[model samples]
Target: MYKVIRKILFLLPPEEAHYVSLFLLQLICSTPFTRKLLRNFFEPVKVSPITIAGIHFRNPVGLAAGFDKNALHLRELSCLGFGHVEIGTVTPQPQRGNERPRLFRLPADNALINRMGFNNDGVVTIAKRLKYWREEVQPYVDLEKPLIIGGNIGKNKSTSNEEAWRDYEFCFERLHPWVDYFVVNVSSPNTPGLRALQDRSFLEKILTGLQKKNQEMKNPKPIFLKIAPDLEWIQVDEVIELVLAIGLDGLVVSNTTIRRDALLTPPNTVSRMGAGGLSGAPLKERNTSLLAYIHKKTNGKIPLIASGGIFTATDATEKFKAGASLVQVWTGFVYEGPAIAKNISAASPV
Candidate 1:
């Protein structure tokens, strides 16, 4: 059914199609009758519990950060059956992202390239909505064992690289209470000069600042770093060092890659879609290798939340065998539709 719907959705502009699909989810999951009925469409199957940092997730498959920029779909998304849903990459203030045509679909290769530069309603607005979820919806959703929520934080576009840590600090303080864990996103290609924060010195400083605040908190949540798949080998080594030096809780094995190679889509089509992060099947090998490499360097000391081209159960299994404690889905969810979480988990080693 989703594949058929995907065929129809594919015809529309990718951005429009995204909104439409979310609308349908909101529409169905909002109604009590529809919500109950739709539950049957998504069957829940227990794989195994995954413990990372200090919390336990029902399954290893999670929806990656960019999918739900704000916490708007918390209720609806949980209904789609993801073990966890990461929201944000949200900034200090809301900003209309780059011009449209920012999201492009490459169906030929089951991938997507997006330059949707941290487009979100900022932290304040998102906090208000999040408060409602945290206060009202989340409690009722089962606090004893509620669905996991991760806050993926990033700085605003206007912030200079020198003052960037302030932006991350601002967001960390605000989202600290609501989210279950944190992913410090400094690797997005869409944001100008943002990737520069990946530098070992700067990244250590940023994580150290956040870690200090977390330690002071009455309740400190797990904070992880999200790095770019485009990093050079030396850069990866720097990251491994940073993770160990800071004692960061974990690492999300990637954001997206800027390098576009072996894409089934023609160069002309890709060139027209210019300037965005490439994610999907093209990312599977690199993402898996990254996890393996990081595991080897860290000696399996740091936890890893693998993200990249997870289109099927096989792709997910590779991540698990490679050393990922958990896995996140982005391009797969877009191309494979809602059953993806269940589909992947059903066949995973976990």
Candidate 2:
């Protein structure tokens, strides 16, 4: 069924098809009856609930960040049976991001390449929408428990690296009240010099600053670092050092990769779509290996959320065996449709 729908959607431009699909989904899920029906479609057989970073999740399969940049579709998406929905790589202020044709489909590779830069509705606007969900919509849905929502935050593109901590700080403080957890997004390949924040000094400054502020709150949210898959083993070790030093909650094992190695897609075709993060099937091995390495390096002390290239229950089971406590999907969700979560959950071991 999804193959047919995807074939039709593929005829449209990638980004256009994305909005059209989401808009249609939003409309369909607007009604209580429709939402309920959609929710049960391919709903997973029960999987035991697990707690991660002090939050309860019905299952480990979650929609990754960037799929719902504005936090507008959590209610609708949650109904699709994801254990959680992470919203945004949202910035402190709104920005248009990279120019059009920024998103491309590599059907041959079963992947997507995007230079979307962190295009989003900004933290302030997003917070207002989340407030409504928490205050009004969630109770009405009346699920067994509140759906987990992680706020994935980043600095505005215009912000220089020197002052980037302020931008992360701004979003962190603003979203602290609305989200169940936070993910600092410094790994996006589209954002200029953004990955520099992964440096030890810069990371220490931003994470420690957020942690200090978190301590002041009546209730602080769990914060995780989203790193790029392109990092070296030495760089990853630095990340491990920082995670332990700051007592950070966990790590989202990876974002997308800037590398384009070993793809089934034609080189000329991929070169034509140049300079964006590549994500999907090609990412599975690197991401899973990184997950296992991190887990082993940290001696499984740091909780981890696996992201990148998870397209099936088997892929997810591999991540679990690699030491991921939770997992998220972006390209898989795009390629496999809403049932990706339910299918993976049903196949998950209790």
Candidate 3:
């Protein structure tokens, strides 16, 4: 059914297709009857719940960050049966991201290349939306379990690296009350100098500041770091060491990769897509390996949420086998249609 729908959607531009599809879903979900019908049709079979960093996830499959950048579609997205929906790589202030044509599809490779540059409605606005979801919409959603919400926060592209910690701090404070967990995003390749925050000195300052603020809250949310898959092993070691030392809650295992090697997409075609993080099937092995490395290096002390190339039960099971406590899907959700979470959860052991 989605294959036929996808063909129609594929005719439009990738970014255009994204919103058009979601808008249609949101329209269907606007009514209580249709919403409940959609929920029943798409909801995953009940699986034993799992807890990580003190948050309960009804299933391991979640929609990754960048899907609902502004917290606009939580009610509609919840009906699709994701155990969690991570919103934002939100900045302290809203900014129009890089130019259009920033998001591209690599259908031959089952991949997407995006240089979205954290284009979002910013922290304050998104937080308000989240608060509304919790206070108004969540209660009426006919689901057996609550959908977990994660805030994936980042600095504005204009923010200097020296002052980047402050940006992260600002976002964390605003979003703390609303999101179930927070993912510090220093890994996105689209934002200029953003990835530099992953350096030990810079990263430590940001994580420690956020942690300090977190502790001050009566009920602190879990803090996780999202890293790029292109990192060298030494860089991974630095990240693992910092995470263990700071008592950070977990790692998201990966963001998208800047590397474009080994793709089925033609070189000229991929080059034309240009300068965005690459994600999807091309990412699975490296991300899985990174998860395993972190799991072994931390001796399983740090919980991990696998993201990247997960599109099916087998992909998800691979993540679980590599010690991921949870998994997130962005490109997979786009490529696999609405049943992605349900399909993966139904077959995954975790």
Q: For each candidate, what TM-score against the reference? A: 0.97, 0.98, 0.99
lDDT of 1 by residue, 102-196 (tens): 99999899899999999999998887888889888867654655679999999999999889899999998988878889999999999999999
In model 3, state the lDDT of residue 192: 91
Prediction 2 TM-score vs. true: 0.98
Pairs with backbone N, CA or C atoms under 3 Å apart (clashes), candidate 3: none
Q: Per-residue lDDT of 1-350 in model 2, one digit per residue for the tens?
A: 99999989999999999999999999998888998898778456777678998999988889999999999888878888888889999899998889999999998898999999889988899999999989989988845766899999999999998899999999988888899999999999999999999999999999999999998899989999999999999999999999999999999989999999999888999999989999999999999999999999888999999998999989999999999999899998888987888889988763
Write down the lDDT that model 2 would get: 0.91
For candidate 1, the per-residue lDDT at 312 reads: 89
Find the 10 residues in a row with the least total lDDT in model 3. Answer: 136-145
How much is the lDDT of residue 120 in candidate 2? 92
Better of 1 and 3 by TM-score: 3
- Candidate 3 residue-wise lDDT, 1-350, digit = tens: 99999999999999999999999998898898998798889889856589999999988999999999999999888889888999998899998999999999999999999999888998988999989888988877834589999999999988899999999999999999899999999999999988888999999999999999999999999999999999999999998999999999999979999999999989999999889999999999999999998998878999999998999999999999999999999999888999998899999996
Candidate RMSDs in Å, in order, are 1.2, 0.9, 0.9
Ranking by lDDT: 3, 2, 1
Q: lDDT score, residue 63, model 1?
A: 93
Q: Model 3 TM-score? A: 0.99
lDDT of 1: 0.89
Runs of candidate 2 with Cα error greater than 4 angstroms are none
